[model samples]
Target: MKKILPAILLALLFILTASSVGYAADIQMKVDGVTILAEVKPEMKNNRMMVPLRVISENVGANVHWSGTEVALTKNDRKIVLTLNSDKAVFNGKTVLLDAKPYLKDNRLFVPLRFLAQSFGCTVNYSHTTVSVDTKPFYIDGVQVAAVQEEIQMTMGSIVDELQGHAYIETMYNLLMQNKGNEVEAPARISLNVHNRLPGDYDQVVQIDFVGENGDSITSFGLYAEVPSEGEDEGEPKVVIYAETEKRWYAFSSKASQEIWELNAIAGKNGFLTMISNTTP
Candidate 1:
């Protein structure tokens, strides 16, 4: 009777745990080391782990759109289309099969997490109640990008900003990648002994730092708009890009400079923080 009683208690505990696994609010999703506080938590269906599709995909820098019940995810030149209640998904122009069908629960679309991670060149690991996703870093000229920084000199004082998240960081990187400038010689340094200089000569409009996991800046590029130059566009006051790692300078493309200034215009509006949802541990 004693052995039978112990077995019955164990079975009861197993039943309780099994019932909760299907839908539990304690489940968490972490991207690039930051916990995501989502309105609808993770769930298990047909023995597969399901996650909120838009919440997970957008955080990884993908653009998600929907047409009726069909959803399309675009990122890094790759596209994926998923239909509700269908196991088929179009991946990069190729139709493929998903492990489970997508469904709506509590007004949120849920899909298998594995398919979303792999399609975006990310690594995923599921353990206990948490799903961790690590995305690939941005790179330019064979150099890895770490973070984006901005500084503006206003009449009152100086305004500084540090940017985070894929929207800001990735957008900046893509802009730079699209606009490659002409290589040029480095500019002169600021010194009181100099005969004559302008405020623009002594200050950089903004700078971006590429940092690694060690917290050390691998490389930093500064955008100089007021520096004196012998180039043809002297009167126009062209922007200059100085690469610290290479110790070289490049003429900032005119179009790119315009976009950068536009980006600078809003750097201090509310600080350059990105879309951060409720965060869990």
Candidate 2:
């Protein structure tokens, strides 16, 4: 009787496990409006959602590292550490308890969804078996800017004249425009330093500061370029631009103005100093 009972219990457990596995495939996960097609879908454990660690982390711009049974995630100034099968995690060097611990499943590290989302400074929403994660805000010198899907395009001449008084901007602009095709090369990512207080125009005005890849201070500005898509033979090449701020990095292009120039200025006692001055002749 004991042997028969044990066999029946093992069979029932296998059936339950198989059912849960099937349900895991049905759970949907979205990050910042993009759907995540994880190799191993998320599953529920004790009513908590657990997701694949690397898949979600990289998607949200977090760096992931693994050492033995420990996993570490670093994003911006925050760091998170989690150990296998342990309900404890270290967030930014502070130990915190987890509702559902991380574990290894199907050769992938699965972590608690809510804990991971909150740790990365993202907001989480769960409904109807779908999990949505909105990444933390991008900041610039403590001020929050509205997220835009397009990038601003400025020519070398316009950027140089607008930042005429600034030595750093002048030097960088000269270096960037030295070569004939330099502007067409990869545009340098830059941060802005805005001075003065102006209502409703804060987002448009900023002093440009460019930093080179080697951490050396350089000057450059982003411009739009159109590149042909793969397998495309004719038609217009898609325009793209790469622009970065202190808080966020954007790779976008505007459809309205492919080669348009607009004048910008700052109100001063004497008159107005040109901010976004002239364009290419």
Which candidate ranks first by lDDT, i.e. highest?
1
Candidate 2 lDDT (Cα, 0 to 1)? 0.54
Best by the TM-score measure? 1
Count of backbone collisions in candidate 2 = 0
- Per-residue lDDT of 1-281 in model 1, one digit per residue for the tens? 99999999999999998778543657787776666656677777777879888666756767789999999989878898999999999998899999999999888899988888888888899888888878887655555655565555443444555665444467676666566578976666632223455544644665676554455676667777655554445555666787777788888776787776565443323234442222222
TM-score of each: 0.61, 0.47
Cα lDDT for residue 55, candidate 1: 68
Model 2: residues >4 Å from true position, as ranges? Answer: 1-21, 139-281
Residue clash pairs of candidate 1 = none
lDDT of 1 at 161: 58
lDDT of 2 by residue, 50-148 (tens): 988866675565667889899888866889999999999999999999999888888888899888888777789987768888775433344332221
Q: Cα RMSD for candidate 2?
A: 17.0
